[model samples]
Target: MEFPSRDLELATRQATLESDTPQIVGPQVVLGQGGFADDDAPENALVAVRDQSQWYVADSLHQARELAGKVQGRRSSLEPRPPLELPEGDWALTLRTCWVEPAYLETDASWCNPQDEPADPVANGGAFGGKIASDVTDVARELAQANDRVVRVLWSREDTVRHGPKRPPVSVGLRADGSGIFRLARTDHIDERIRPLLPKCEIEQVTIPGPPTSSAIRGAGWAEVEMLRAGLSGQAGWVTAPSGASAKATIANELISVEVRAGSPLDWVMFRSYCIGAAHMAYSWVTSEGLSVDQNGDVHDLTIRSFGVLRSSDTPEI
Candidate 1:
């Protein structure tokens, strides 16, 4: 059987500051040997796991997953609430951050010893800001000191799905004059973050009993607004980040073409990879990825596979 080859292209930047090089760990990562937080733990380190119930000791991955399932089964179910009300306008939209968890391969992990500070929760790959407030490091340190031994605190797949921060779901209404209403799930600083982007739109931050939300998710509040405005105007979607990076994307015949200018990238190889990745993420989020959450705010998709992430075979050429 012949397999198709995937190629990488390094486009020239507008300005050249330094010669670019492939990431040092690229080969290791491709070969599945990147040093993750848990893999770097001491051989003698004890394992710890947590869920809604509480933190507890686990001897292995299987045991940890089993414990998490038990904890999930014990939580009380809530009555589903009424559907979100969409504001009336020329264009009304309601969007959910269903498949928004970072779901990084290395489910939150950290290690700590009695004599040293806790290991960093993030090792090589990032968690898309989902791990910014993770308590695994603190728990690892506490367990290590109490047990007087090296300890590795890890989050099971279910735990990550339940505890990770999600992109805030939003309801938007846009008028022909570019003024409208934007209703967002309650989250910190979300209004301030998006005020400048859609100043004419009335931003309403509503409290809902759902998974915790964060503006840190890739273009959480503003991206929705930009896409809506672009769609309404029959123009390509345009988005600008706080870091001065900007991108435009358009969809035709089921293909999304994107153009980005992030200003003089440090590494063209990494830049190309990131660009392709972002495109893939956008494609998957729209077509394949999503979580099944109840109206009561309980997440029904607990397993990593349940989130409907697009597999490599199912992904389109980017």
Candidate 2:
């Protein structure tokens, strides 16, 4: 896997600056597991300070100064107070320019129920791009009723993954009769949290009690099912069999192989490419027996670069 080179460089620079400081207050240090580093620690007074006492050292120089201001405020004894007024406005929106494909709409549609009305119809795009539309709507309706003002709802990608409904994981058991015919039994472990979130679907699900990670991405389950189905069918040698009665006779007599490999990108990329090429060949064989070239070719590949600066003060309140 490719490591974060740019992030490491910034971290190294911050470390060099931090080494200059002899000591930091307990409340002025923040420790995080991953992502950007920021010093948003609670305020405490520095003891035994000399004339040249270092105030702040941060990943970003600007952030260091911001931390100095925070530390200064904390050191000065003052009564704790909240903001007197909240900022009021109809905010402008901007989306991150990521590799988002319009064709990916299928995944979004599968997760949301169009018939279900948003809780705050005025602000329809609720958290996580409608990943929790129902829940958001419910909250918005309640808030709107209490405060007779239009409330706008917005969802960040992170929020969507954290709180949005997830696709349930499924396990399938297949028994082949040494013939083309196979018996399949599927068991799906549906998340109880998502039961209330999703509209009624055709599949009957069994609820399992456990702590499911909220970071489960979209189509998390379908990929596994597709892999299993492909392997099972491939093992049975169903791909090579001719159509009609002859194919039926060979189905029961054929042997199938199922192989699973877990590895990093460098270890598996070549194998993955070979598998994809084979799959395309198989598709051509099934659809047009003699077609040798790809019909839908690659259009274009594009890359964009940008810079993101994270300050200690900008850290999210978890």
Cα lDDT tens digits, model 2, 138-191, are 543333343443322322222222233432333233333111211111223333
Decoy 1 TM-score against native: 0.81
Q: Scored by CA lDDT, what does every candidate get?
A: 0.68, 0.25
Task: For model 2, state the Cα shift of residue 140 in Å.
Answer: 1.5
TM-scores of the candidates are 0.81, 0.25
Clashing pairs in 1: none
Please, what are the lDDT tens digits per residue for candidate 1 over residues 61-156?
Answer: 557557655544222233223224777656644343443555667688899998899977765545666776778899998999998988889887
For model 1, the superposed segments whose C-alpha errors exceed 4 Å read: 1-24, 58-83, 88-99
Error of 1 at 272 (Å): 1.2
